[model samples]
Target chain A: MSARVFINEVAPRDGFQIERDFVPTAAKIALIDDLSPLGFAKIEATSFTSPKAIPNLADAAEVMTGIQRQPGVDYVALIPNEKGVERALACGTDELNFVMSASDSHGRANLRMTANQSLERFEHMVALADGHNVFINASISTAFGCPFEGEVRPERVLEIVARAQARGIQGVTLCDTTGMANPRQVASLCAEALSRYPDMALTLHLHNTRGMGLANAFAGYEVGVMRFDAALGGLGGCPFAPGASGNVCTEDLVHMFEQMGVHTGVDLERLLGVAEQLPTLVGHDVPGQVVKAGTSQRRYPLPDAIG
Target chain B: MSARVFINEVAPRDGFQIERDFVPTAAKIALIDDLSPLGFAKIEATSFTSPKAIPNLADAAEVMTGIQRQPGVDYVALIPNEKGVERALACGTDELNFVMSASDSHGRANLRMTANQSLERFEHMVALADGHNVFINASISTAFGCPFEGEVRPERVLEIVARAQARGIQGVTLCDTTGMANPRQVASLCAEALSRYPDMALTLHLHNTRGMGLANAFAGYEVGVMRFDAALGGLGGCPFAPGASGNVCTEDLVHMFEQMGVHTGVDLERLLGVAEQLPTLVGHDVPGQVVKAGTSQRRYPLPDAIG
Candidate 1:
């Protein structure tokens, strides 16, 4: 039997923040309410970043408080810094995810600080969450490769992950922020990281920009990495990377995993129903293919002899 | 060092046949001429099926005779029967691809015969091409799973492939006719087929209806299958399968392989250029993702902040 893999839905936060139009807190909470019972390990409710930086997620506190918490699901929020962490904790978020880039150039563009500054700040945030019951997870953006810096060396990514681990972070996410990851690179990095830090919970946050998102995820799985991040309707892309596409579609990823006998605990039909609502909410067609194509077992009737 | 993989371009035949408007003969010749030098092991130039069945490929003779052939490339023509074999031989085709479905339901729908009758006809077609100095390759459609039959037994597929092999066929293609294959199924089938017929050259013809095309291709590669068939712009879905998508995009497949350090010997930039031209010819936007989102190595300039 295959081991169980975790599907962490990041649509409400990562997917919504990139959209120019504002999704009201009620709709966001409603979607999360519908998604809560679909068997995801976590749902990233919203981001606690500055409203000026990301106007779409200005209702972070409202969304975090508004969602009817599912018994088994963790409601998480993205924390930009200490202020964000304070807001997240006050909102009663079950977990806090902090972002730092592996490359200094990307770090400055995304976080408005160098990699070192972000790493240093994560330590203080960890201390801030010390007394709280909330879990802490750190994400290393551009871990596979960077848009500005081009190919990010594996050593740079390892350093950032190592620092996060040293700070006693519960989980560390290696983000392929620009969708520039390949299977071999992912396999190599995952092998090395898991070999070195066997105890650290490693997750992969991949984008389908170049259509290699699922391919890279499969590679990571081959190396024994279990957790993955995806968004419904293929929403979310790196705002800094030019021409980049959305995150891997959660339904498509779940479809692939379920078909391969990898248990993800996701109800595909219900998840697909949630994904079907994305086009109206996002005000455009989504990048997802599974919704348009249907599942593999969805068969067509036989045509007559003339047809 | 990585082993070299063979890419067979099937857009001219498989892709064009599905379109409503007939591409001009001159345009077809021009596209094939452009594709000839792109380092594909073979180009499926055209099909010799009855015009009533596939009107788009009616100019088979013109297409077979019109192009300038690259020295290392093999120009192939699809033969539907003894009549098609005669036509292909007259056109000086390098190889003849005979197709028969593994399931009788699909065979009747596609070939107007039962599986056994089609296999018997293929044996006759083999004799017809025996002294012509042309190669013979047989394709088993619905080899993975059939849309009508629901689940095609693996034993049925192996029987057809073994019969083809016994007929002195050099290459055999296991076609996922309606994109119904999952990675585990592909891996298992490929492993079993390769183990039984160690000398037979196996190729995978996959579709992306459920978005597992690249994942399935990667699985096949992992199981020691080196040859793959793809359409230029994700064109060519099974006409019989409702809501079906296109063939695995050639550029997407090449991108995955090249990123994983596997060599396909195809120039990606030039292939993308050809793929870009497919929209006008087919009168619709192609399903390929790499053209919209450029190659992983295509780097963007950094922002002004010391980037």
Candidate 2:
């Protein structure tokens, strides 16, 4: 296993998109700017989807332009089609994230099309942005299993990746949209994906819906995956999938990996300070454990009376 | 690996003991009876500690005597001293659980005695109950690490196990008192314990204080551990330890294991129904993931509008 791993912070986009209340553009910019220097390999700054689909992210263009840029950080924006691509490119997004479901039922339910049609739409976006300097990354949602469809085949995901690869996409994230993955399943699928696409940079976007998110991440790590996508305080989940909870918490994931001797290079205390502010901003408690319970290394003083 | 594993339910004793409001004796019995037929290998019915110490469990004797017992189910009780042993034997508990800290500072702080002193007290109880038809299980709390004293050596746990083994104890529970255990640490210590005492049965009692409860359990399971302790709704924590959260949730643990094709023999639906009742019982939301997110295999219907 590598001594260091990379975390792509997705709370500003993935987390905030699911909230009912629209966070102010200034607040979104401030949170992203606060996280810019926290040693994140990538920051999913905002999404270029229509305001009608996600009104919370309507100020995406302003937030994208407002945040102070760090030198080494890759600022990413989620884009669905050619229109989103045009918007993201106009804002000078460092990376554009395209997504489609591996399960046809999920694709139909989520994107109003089949998997092939979504891939074709992605191809159109890729063809339209041919001269742009930005990198393109694809996410296969419900890659492990889908709520609408009981099980998703690995071959289907591979087929989607093959299409993305043909369109010159270098990275793909396999998302457990409802957190239905087990460790052995994760190990086997990740191993299979690596075997089939040796050069494609793979990242796992897991949710803590069933509390197996970190376990799945560890299994993926054991099988040689070095990149993961997480949200601050486990912020987001698919609204369409019933019983789906939050994404894996960034601070919690970093704490676990760092405790296991893998370096994240992110200051946990500072990250925790940011996570602590999430409840007040979002108006409810978050699902992250490390925020309520401090890191394991925190010590307690002995009782004075010893009763 | 075995197809089946044993989960010892500790909610009644471990979870209820920490609550500020005392659960009624009849209610405790009702919950235990409800859990009796849900396929738990063992249920820690109550603790026979002094009423003055833990007023929440002051009705331990009544709760133990009132529960409806199921065939093949081992109903256990926690016993802190000779007085507790006497009370437990009177209630006809199948197993008497004894506890000692692996760290001397924790031992002094929790039990008001040294580790050696606690072991001697256990030996006296063994002699006093020589002819009794009951099993003895000792838990070495802070086996992984201690909040009062940092980094408890594995040798300390080994030493306690040796003493318990010499006194004819059938099993030993290595508790992560403050949930400081990582996967590597659990794997190494469990391997060493098995190597040193090949015939003695080992069980892991982990806390989810740092959100590593299931990960630690998986590590232990990988290293030949077939038994674990968990509370329903993830509803227990150390009263003395600051920032301590709940124990690993029984429904969540069984959910993960069952999803991985490991048979826990726990009925997920029935267990969930019981877990659903806990929020009202405790007057707060639980920490269990499955209670909120449902099982990984749970399917959702496709949206009619798909908008």
Candidate 3:
């Protein structure tokens, strides 16, 4: 139990971003408010992207302002540029997340620019947020394996990391944008990235697309990487990224890690309760397990064996 | 590439065993017939157990005789006792899969006998099948963790394996009865089990309850355990195991092994074709990703490029 794990809840930003049905601002606030008391270290509240881009999250500011932020919880918001950063700043977010794709193909498809241009844009956004108490984290999408490109090389991922470090970002998350990575790929890339930038905060963001989400997360843990981003209710996927299942389910990751004697600081039972509301919320059965199947300890009494 | 990889196709037996909706015997035969051409060296076709317990598979005899048997494919079936063995033998099957539980509680619950009684019955079943020209595979269910007993000690698993050896059973599959195993537990247990019984054909049958199914498979693979049991479209779970999500999705496992260059003889495209029918068949979206999301070589074009 000496292991302390960071659980970064990404449901509001990543989960709501990809969901088909529009969840009202009140529901979004209620979801975050419901999760705030669960001992989570960080909860990504919402994204400041254009309403036209992610229509479901059009009321991002309302959700951000409405939620009751528990003491010691860091409420972060996803910001794309100077404008989005300004919006998140007004919402009083404690942290700001800026995402840019690593692969040129993904960068073009996702961000409408070349890799270098995305890097330059991230630098400008970081500079704009200077002197604020807001902590900045730059995430690279498709860092593991891109659908547009069949294989992602580690050097390409390293190049993105070096660029992020140069921009004075405090942290970075290597994302398997399309979930095409195996454990070997995850081990190789994360080991290299963490070794090269030991001081930078690193996290693994993954989808259960090919069913390697938890495995890849373990690979990160084995390589001495902690701080993973997951969505409650198994809510996430990039519409642009092919083979994208939902993000690794929050309760499933919590269940696996907490059972393994890793301290995720997450309340498993509460998370499962929140996850139960998702199917009705999104109008589809989600891809998380612990949420549907209660913990092993939460079992019904069995009948006695007959002679 | 020199690694020995074996696949135990449980689509016929485990796949259809838990379904409420009946697949016609003709369709079941056609499914197995279609799978035989895909280079599966071994396939578990049906269970010869009493139909009183599992009515969906009452027509086991018809399934064994109806399918177009491919040359070199070891067609196996489940047998509980002498009567089941006689039926499997009469059908001219190639392999006999006799399952005994590792945990006493699960043993009695599933087989209506104590652990020792199950082993004693297995000895008789093996003796009766001697000179019957059927390959014997002894599977130990609840080998990882049992729903009844909180944690099934690996020592108990080794005990079951030793019993199978004494009874002259040629192979053994260690199953996670309630999908309650993590990768470290999976690897450590497989290593411990493999060390004691190196010559016994070792296979792992996993459930995806906690989302660690493929990770557990990889852990077992890392420990030099090759053979694995999987179902198409994640379509199976023990009815007795409350809240067990389903068996490991066959295509997901195939995707991992094939990506890492471990041969399993499954074509992803062909497997996805089978998976595409799952939603229509089950009347809901099955918990599989590769079928809905194309392979890496395949990708959907996305707009709004940064690169």
Candidate 4:
């Protein structure tokens, strides 16, 4: 049997946050409820950031509290600071995902704080969850490369991981915020990170901006990194990264992994069914290919001339 | 330094053949002329098949004879039979890429011949080029899986390779004609083929229909298969495979390889300049990502808020 992989769906938070129009609170809840039984290891249901910054997900508390959670699936909420952590805890979030940036410029541009400031704030955020029964994950944005500051050194990313670990964060997601990562860099970084912190849950958050998302994910997987963060229909893009595209499509990722004989524990047919509804929900076509073209298992009839 | 890889541009033939409106002969020549100086290892200029079958490429001779060929680039023509060989040789083609399908149903549907029939015809075709100073390659279509008949066994593909070698074919391309291949399957087959016939040139032809194209290419690269067949702006699709999209985008493939530190001889900046013209030439938006999202080296100014 192939080793099973973990997928964390982030469309609701990461994907919806960037939409021009706010996804209605009930629609968000309905979507999460629909996705809960699909066997994802985790679902980032919403973000508890300031409404002024990300108005699309202003209904974070409503989304976190409204969805009927399923057992064995951790419902995660993106928490940016101590107040966000407290809000997520009040909504009974299963996991608190702390957000930061590896590059100081990106940290300042996106979150109005530098890397050091974010790390300093992570301490207070983690402290807010001390008595609560919740998992903590720190997402290091632009860990691969920054749009404002290009070539974020692997050393900087490792340093941030080390700092997050020191703050009692159990997991770290190395994000390619602008889809600037290549497969070789991914393999090297993932291998080094896995070797150094074998106990920590290291997740890969890749974007399809330059079309290297799956390739980078596979590289990470080849180097023993198991968890991945993906969005439905490849939705989500960093507003700061001009001309950038979406997060790696959840269905496409699962389809590729399943086709490669790796177990993703995802019901692909059911997942694709949900993926098909994305365009209607978002009022636009998405960047996903698997939903547009069926899975590899799909067989077509011979051309009419042959038949 | 990373190993140098070969990229064979296939847009002139594989991409243009499927277009609804025939690309004018002069335009075809112009495109090929523009591409010749970009340092492609080989360019499949056009197909020498009967115009009735592929009307879009009716000016195969015009395209082949019109282009100002570069010294380092080999100009290839898709040869379906002895007649194609005769025509390609008349056009002074550097290489003749003979086409065949691995599955009998696909063979009959696409080429009106079974695998055995195509192989038997290869002898006559090879004999036609016996005295000519031209390289010969066989592209095994649907080598990974057939849309009609699913799951093509690895043994069957190997057998076809052996037969092609016996018939004096110098290179073979394992084509996922309809994007049905997975990375694990690609790696395993490529490893086996390379081990058994270390002398023969092997190439991978993938499609992004299901979004595993670059990942499959990387898998093949990891196993030491160095040559790839990509189309400009991800043009080309299998007509027999319903809902299938284009071949892997050439610029995207090159970007990934270059970013990973692998040296592809082609100049990427010049290639992207050509790729940017694809939409105007083809009268449609192309699937390539690198052109839309600049290379990883691209940097953006900090947002107005930060500045």
TM-scores of the models, in the order given? 0.98, 0.97, 0.94, 0.99
State fnat for each of the candidate structures: 0.70, 0.66, 0.52, 0.80
Report the C-alpha lDDT of model 3 over B1-307, residue by residue, as the tens digit: 2255777789778878888787778888888887887767788999998998778788999999988888978999999888999999999999999988887777777888777888899899999899988889988898877777778888878988998889889999999867888887888888988888888888899988778888888888888888999888887876656566789988888888887778887666787887787677656666676777766556655554443
TM-score of 3: 0.94
- Residue A177 in model 4: lDDT: 91
Query: What overall lDDT goes with each candidate model?
Result: 0.88, 0.88, 0.82, 0.92
Please give, for residues B172-236, the per-residue lDDT of candidate 1 as tens digits: 99999888888888989998999999889899998987777888888888888999999998888
Clashes by residue pair, model 4? none
Model 3 Cα displacement at B63 (Å)? Answer: 2.1
Docking verdict class for candidate 4: medium
Q: Which candidate is the best by DockQ?
A: 4
For each candidate, give the TM-score of chain B: 0.97, 0.98, 0.95, 0.99
Poorest 10 consecutive residues of model 1 chain B by lDDT?
Answer: B298-307
Candidate numbers, best DockQ first, in rank order: 4, 1, 2, 3
lDDT of 4 by residue, B111-186 (tens): 9999999999999999999999999999999999998889999999999999999999999999999998988899
Better of 2 and 3 by DockQ: 2
Chain B only: TM-score of model 4: 0.99
Question: What is the DockQ (computed on Cα atoms) for candidate 4?
Answer: 0.79
lDDT of 4 by residue, A1-307 (tens): 1277999999999999999888999999999999999999999999999999889989999898899989999999998888898899999999999999999888988888999999999998888799899999999999999987899999889988998899899999999998999989999998999899888899999999999889888888888988999999999998866666799999999999999889998899999999999999989989999988898888888778878
Q: List residue ranges in candidate 1 displaced over 4 A.
A: B305-307
Predicted model with the maximum lDDT: 4
Model 4 accuracy (lDDT, Cα) = 0.92
